[model samples]
Target: MTLPSAYTEAPARRFNVGERVRVKLAFPPGHRRTPVYVRGKSGVVERVCGAFANPEELAYGFDGNPKRVLYRVRFRQRELWSDYAGSESDHLELEIYEHWLEAA
Candidate 1:
């Protein structure tokens, strides 16, 4: 069964499939969704995963208003790890929020 969402509409997306983007490297003292290893790494947007409540705020008991766009990004394994010894086509996919990404 489909459940009604609290948000009336999805937030505007800042990226599209195949667009190159970089993860923001900022580290704030609070709950975060973005991982440390992926910070500052460049990747391509594989697909749009739609917008959802901001978990960081939700974790702190806020209403989680202003939904954020989430994306599935594709990063080459070699680019993430300098000593990676996988095939050239090897890559990693991560679900990153819009606030954690920037133009590459």
Candidate 2:
């Protein structure tokens, strides 16, 4: 089956490479894109993935209002995963929607 176009459009105001950002996870029974593993963690903005439809809306049978920005945030593996086995500089990149971020 084909997915909705709102899920595929590119973002217009994504975070710049090397910028610092924080992820905001929705709380209380919401299964979210921002992993629980990374909550309250600080990371660097690595790349922009651009805007797409909001996942929350789609979850409730509504066409999500798309935001204008998205980002690829790079966090240290040690910061996210408790049992991370890599070096201190080892990083993980997450494709985060704009609404999930704020200035850090």
Best by lDDT: 1
Clashes of each: 0, 2
Question: 1-104 in candidate 2: lDDT tens per residue?
Answer: 11223334353564666778888755647645777766677788766666767776777877877644667788888978888887988888788777778777
Model 2 regions more than 4 Å off: 1-14, 81-83
With candidate 1 superimposed using the best TM-score fit, by how many Å does residue 65's alpha carbon deviate from the native?
0.8
- What TM-score does candidate 1 reach? 0.87
What's the TM-score of every candidate structure? 0.87, 0.74
- Quickly count the clashes in candidate 2: 2
Local accuracy of candidate 1 as per-residue lDDT tens digits, 11-92: 4788977899999988888999898989999999877778889999999999887888988889999989999998999999
Report model 2's TM-score to 2 decimal places: 0.74
lDDT, candidate 2, at 28: 47
Model 2: ten consecutive residues of lowest lDDT: 1-10
